[model samples]
Target: MTVAVATIGFTKTTAENFFARLKAAKVKRVIDVRLHNTSQLAGFAKADDLAYFLKTINGMDYVPEPILAPTEELMKFFKTDKGDWDVFSRDFSALMKERKVEKALKPSFLDGACLLCSEATAHRCHRRLVVEYLNKEWSGALTVAHL
Candidate 1:
């Protein structure tokens, strides 16, 4: 059976809406793919706060998977320098390949999981790339939905 995974960003969502979405999706685990999750800008989505909320709200387990996140250099260039996405994608893809992220994340952790980042959309975030890369590397064993 194909493992189903969902992706989400917290920028445009409130605490209520965020947990509601996760509950509705029946996400059993939340994988945080953010390199930095403690920023004040994250507010309710802060690492500690989100973990607590997920457990209280949906009995979901929170797992921080930083290996799936882009390198600090790539993030700075993309987020601060307004770098090209294609370039970032290429560079980050190479990094993922080098790191062998597919082998690092356990199949059990990915099953019924939601990948969390802060972009508000999966369109141009590393979280999206991570899922896409995994889908390809895993021989389409993963089904992904951006929420």
Candidate 2:
């Protein structure tokens, strides 16, 4: 089964606690879907840096798949009649079909996969949309958890 996991809160999650939760979950990789990857958070600013820390420090694989990133076009669309969700959902599904996220996720999904972004609650983040798209469109089995 393909599982998509994501963190709920961003600013509140400490790197230590985040890593600890990931270890406990036995998550093999973390797929970051932030449109802008740079974060004020010290450890999660860069993809490479986060990946390194995930692997070297937490022993979990890290993969950045921006296809899941919410773009301006997506944001603009989402602001309208919830039509943006349709557009974003379509584009995201297309990206997955193209194997873009799958390709980037290659080694990571061998065990299990989780998506990450900077929101304290999945319901409050675009990552929620991505997770929904994955679970519904791709029929990917998913569970969202916070750390």
Judge candidate 1 against the unseen true structure and give its global Cα lDDT, from 0 to 1.
0.89
lDDT of 2 by residue, 70-114 (tens): 666655666444664556666656655665554444332533666
Question: In angstroms, how far off is 125's CA in candidate 2?
Answer: 0.7
Q: List candidate 2 stretches off by more than 4 Å.
A: 1-9, 73-111
C-alpha local distance difference test of each model: 0.89, 0.64
Off by over 4 Å in 1: none
**CA displacement after TM-score superposition, residue 65 of candidate 1 (Å):** 0.7
Judged by lDDT, which candidate is best? 1
Root mean square deviation (Cα) for candidate 1: 0.9
What are the TM-scores, per candidate, against the unseen true structure? Answer: 0.96, 0.68
The digit string of per-residue lDDT tens for model 1 on 13-129 reads: 788888889999999999999999886776888899989989988999999988998888999999899999999999999999999988987565788999999998899999999
Q: What's model 2's TM-score?
A: 0.68
